[model samples]
Target: MTLPLSGLAFPPSREPSTRVPADLRKQGFGVRIAEQRDLGFMRALYETLRAEEMARVAWPEGARQSFLDSQFTLQHRHFTTQFQHAEFLVLEHRGQAVGRLYLLRESPRWLVIDIGLLPAWQGRGIGGALLRQLQRDAQGSHAQGLALHVRLDNGRAHALYVRLGFREQGGVEGLHQRMHWDVPTAVAQLNTA
Candidate 1:
């Protein structure tokens, strides 16, 4: 069930693909499958993602560094092994890599394993466009919705998900909140609109 790192297989779509919404394309936003050359960037971004949480632990500098290294390694291994078919995408805007998106398609749902953008790229519409595209993809399949896990302390990310129509399903592993964006409800609202 392992998908090649080049593209994703959507159930209803006839072909494997990578896409940038039309509007996003006009704004120079695009995405591509991550390759070996992108490893450093990916690891650095992962570190940046834990910066806030690492700061809150009150651990000494050496201990904090050790903790981040260990945690990052663990998380990386977990994702690669647990979701072998997931697509790892690199987000680019105006020809610069600004973020990453990891998606795993499971039975009855598409799991958004991780999505993170550099600080300068935050609040832009790239993440929203990527999500909307996923919802569109899900609607065409037997999938129920788009699901993701967001840390409870990441208010900005949590709010973004809420704004995008995801509701808290329940608590997941540790401090993560399991949220879902139901496609049928969204499509129904759109039709009504």
Candidate 2:
């Protein structure tokens, strides 16, 4: 598919629902969402996710493949109309897609199915900004909280979400842990940063 990596959903509002805060905004890497034809953008992003040598080595033999074959198949479908009812966002730098936030809504709770920032665009507060946007959307929908599952070995993602106020709720497959960040905590953390 064509890799149209520059379309950004500036939220359902006329302006950004909330700025990333001036201090943090300056730290913004200018990452935005990829458009409908950006499947090719995902090809490279997924490669980077799997290329984390240390994280890969820590996983059990079948861990990577199973996770990819299952969860990632859901993520890899981000560019399709299948996710039209939900929200899938991308973070771009200059003009290249650099990160993504995939969420699913099941009423009263917004499940953050996946979230990631490319290696090159990290450390710029984009992930946090995007997550806060998710937080806003969740609250506006009157959702109770946000949910996500991250493999135990994915220290990077775990740390980011935790700092964003997501706390462990349960574990699965002896690897991934389910997490949630409620509206109050989410807004507080985002504004604090």
Candidate 3:
């Protein structure tokens, strides 16, 4: 199984698993702690997410796979080493793994390191539901807010973040824009309503 997106690798057997809440199940979604066993699935998913970008360069199959493998390894190592306390979560629709959500909990903010779904899983309201829940959790914990970066060309994701109340703070790196959704605003709206 190939994994989706570029992120940390968790050995399945060593970590405990968790089921989504009953409320989420009613929405046809589930969450579980990703396992080492899911690495293949995660890798495959990452490749799929990169397929379009890789196509632009049109590298030979061997070269493309090699490059992706190296980058994946580097990223996974960086994330795991840097954010030792982050949660490596697998997103499931119904019962099958469809995406991954990597979250880093810090003192006053929760960093959404990555959140990507398979092509087939996009635009199904799953991402929205998950983000809303994360927002709620942030508010509950009195965190500053949630923050994430999206590639400049990833219009779909950027739009979703905006619709979820994230404001574009500025650009990051070369081709990414940093966006933030403030928990205080969310709490204020809820209090007013």
Candidate 4:
């Protein structure tokens, strides 16, 4: 079932700055339901994510574009179809699309289907902030915890998850590994200690 936004402590809305500031990191970030018009930007963001890996492949320009296009299409279709109740949100900073976050609420635990930011927006703690907000939302709703799968090769993201208290669960699934953050247990441990 779809989780109602009214139940969560959603981010506050802010007026977009007229001129890009020197420190854009200080700007407030918010999220909104992604729309059809965002598909192009989202697709380009996906391409940026795979750029490094794609660079390693010695393929013609047209071939590379075609491959990314097909892969993105498949992924988008799969996510939309498989997680019908999930919220597909677009991360915005100063009213500009900076990233995307897909979340699915399954009674006991919330699943992070995907979360990614543009290269320019990375390393600014925005992703972590977004996750922290989600954690709070989950806790407020009395959910058990949050869960997600991280690519085996994504050490940076895996480290972030670990730092956020997510522990590796089960074995690897293909190229990804399952990880979970159990809120009740964590809270209990913290209380006891």
Candidate 5:
């Protein structure tokens, strides 16, 4: 079931803040709220991310494109409508849109609705830096922890989350794995670091 953004019952601790960290800004990385103009780039990025999976299918090019379009639309609609309080951010590199990071901060935990980068931007440490910034934000806001779901087949992402102190909390039978990082755990790791 979906709820309008206005229907959200939990008020945010603070307004959405997309301040790009100084270190990231020095590296030409930044983030901003997604806008209507960004929808095209967002759709293209979505397609690029799914290209590998789509390549295995024998469908015609037109059919593949059509399928991706519909899927992106549905996903976009679901996110915007359901997560009323979520922040839909566009990750930028030197002012060019390169990825997205969606988040929702509730009372106890901050949920990473989704985070994705174009294939060209992968393996560049950008994702880790953004996640680290998010961890700090959650801690500052007094959230108990952070939580997210990762595809079971995404070994790279799973490894990153684990390295960042997220532990499996179980999830769908064969699709995604739920993982969490608690504030206490993050604090402990920080003290030792």
Candidate 6:
């Protein structure tokens, strides 16, 4: 069931049997939970998306830092306390921070509150690789589902999410779509194989 949110389409991820690339072994980058010191790089990644105009996104350049501060709060909590979810991530390639992926867990759903790669790091397979790892990494936690809101105008992310088996859950905040992918199925398949 999906709520009647404007500009939202309820697309759910494909079944666990859905074939995602078996390129898990092809590794070129590394990732880790972000720390307080890494916020600057994270912010830079956020700024990189301003040009996306993301159709449905309305973030002003001035508020990007504060916005990230609040979003990463839970992640900070996870650093000292125990949380069943991961809300902060920093992607590195060639020893340089190039992207950020912030998540928020909601029971059966994990919301990608923020996700963007710097311009210099775009066009590579980095984004897809990150999403794949995130899905695999999230398999045993919460409800084993990965969800995110994409600026309806974020056609690139929308297409990527779809390929990763994420489907719309029909809720919107301006131009974002509530997309989710079932984690357990993915985990189970990985485990069985």
Q: How many clashes (backbone N, Cα, C below 3 Å) per candidate?
A: 0, 5, 20, 0, 0, 9
Predicted candidate 3 versus true structure: per-residue lDDT over 49-166, tens digit per residue: 8888898996787788888887777777777777777788888877889999888778567888888899998888777878888887777675788988898889989898999999
**How many backbone clashes can be found in candidate 1?**
0
Top TM-score hit: 5
lDDT of 4 by residue, 59-175 (tens): 998888888877887788788778877778888887899998888888678899999999999888777777776776766665788999999988999999999999999999999
Worst 10 residues of 1 by lDDT: 7-16
Please give each candidate's TM-score: 0.81, 0.63, 0.83, 0.82, 0.85, 0.61
Please give the TM-score that candidate 6 achieves against the real structure. Answer: 0.61
> Which candidate, 3 or 5, would have the higher lDDT against the true structure?
5
Q: How do the residues 17-124 of candidate 6 rate in per-residue lDDT, one tens digit apiece?
A: 212234523444655566656755644555467544433457674465455455444333443244334445666665677776656556666666666788887777
Runs of candidate 6 exceeding 4 Å displacement = 1-28, 54-85, 140-142, 184-193
As a whole number from 0 to 100, the lDDT of residue 182 in candidate 3 is: 83
The sequence of per-residue lDDT tens digits that candidate 2 reaches over residues 1-193 is: 2233344222221222322334444554443444545555665577577776536366675765555444444545542444554455555555556766666676656777667777876776667777777676676666777888888878877898999889989556566888888778565456446
> Model 5 — TM-score against the truth?
0.85
Question: Which residue pairs of candidate 5 clash?
Answer: none
Clashing pairs in 4: none
Give the alpha-carbon lDDT of every model.
0.77, 0.62, 0.77, 0.77, 0.80, 0.60
Q: Give residue 7's error in model 4 in angstroms.
A: 33
Off by over 4 Å in 4: 1-26, 186-193
- The candidate 4 region of ten consecutive residues with least summed lDDT is 1-10
Return whichever of 1 and 2 wins on lDDT: 1
Worst 10 contiguous positions by lDDT, candidate 2: 8-17
Using lDDT as the yardstick, the better of models 2 and 5 is 5
Tens digits of per-residue lDDT, candidate 5, 65-122, equal 7788778878887887788688888888889898999898886788999999999899
